[model samples]
Target: MSDTDDLVEIEQLLARYAVSMTRGDVDRVLAVFTPDGAYSAFGDTYPLDEFPALISAAPKGLFLVGTPVIELAEDGATAAGTQPLCFVEHAQHGMRIGYYNDTYVRTPDGWRLRTRAMTFIRRSGDHDSGRPHAFTRS
Candidate 1:
């Protein structure tokens, strides 16, 4: 595929992830990542296998993801991207605004995230309630 094609695919991949995660579809969310993928947030990084629980543990919300800025690697096998995120709470009157830093790999199944880290910029209401899952960007 051409670089444009790759960029489109990666953009769609990011959309897929946001939609799936907002819908709380664990399987679909997992599909956007490599089998050995890892997600970092809440001051911890969870392996692919642990992602489901991490998903379940979060409050239900709608993920409003901004357009991603992606940079393809010279090797053509990897890429990096970042996007703004707004997680509006559905289960409660709360919200968490953040951004995602992602590392993508060209798997046989297509572009998948190898690593995804969330950096929270703000939180409020039930979202800021005594849940110890908040973390900062490094």
Candidate 2:
């Protein structure tokens, strides 16, 4: 695929991720990642197999993903990006603002997330305490 095509596909992939998460479809969300992909948030790492349980245990929310800054690799097989996000939890009546740092790789199926690390910058509402506390990995 050409550079333009790659960019469009990558953007669509990111959008799908947000939509899937908002819809609470763990399977669909996982589809955006590679088999060995991982998501790190609050300093904890979740592998693909464990991700669904994590999502299921979390409160449902509205996920808004901002435009990502995608950089294609020179070899055309890998890419990386970062995107700001706002998450509003219905149960908690609060919102968290953060950014996701992502690594992408071209696979036989398509471009997939190799890893995603999220850093929360702010929070407010029922959970208010100024900024949210970061979780430490055990």
* Candidate maximizing TM-score: 1
Model 2 TM-score is 0.86
Query: Model 2, stretches more than 4 Å misplaced?
Result: 123-138
Backbone Cα, N, C clashes tallied per candidate? 0, 0
- Model 1, 1-138: lDDT tens digits are 899999999999999999999888999999999999999887788899888877886788899999999999999999999988888999685877878999999999899999998888753422211224553222
Q: For candidate 1, report its TM-score.
A: 0.87
Pairs clashing within candidate 1 = none
Per-residue lDDT over 1-138 for candidate 2, one digit per residue giving the tens place of the 0 to 100 score: 998899888889999999999999888999999999998875567788878877876668899998999999999999999988898998876887778989999999899999998877743323221223343223
List the lowest-lDDT window of 10 residues for candidate 1.
123-132
- Score residue 100 of candidate 1 by CA lDDT: 90
Error of 1 at 11 (Å): 0.7
C-alpha RMSD between model 1 and the true structure: 4.9
**What lDDT, from 0 to 1, does candidate 2 have?**
0.83
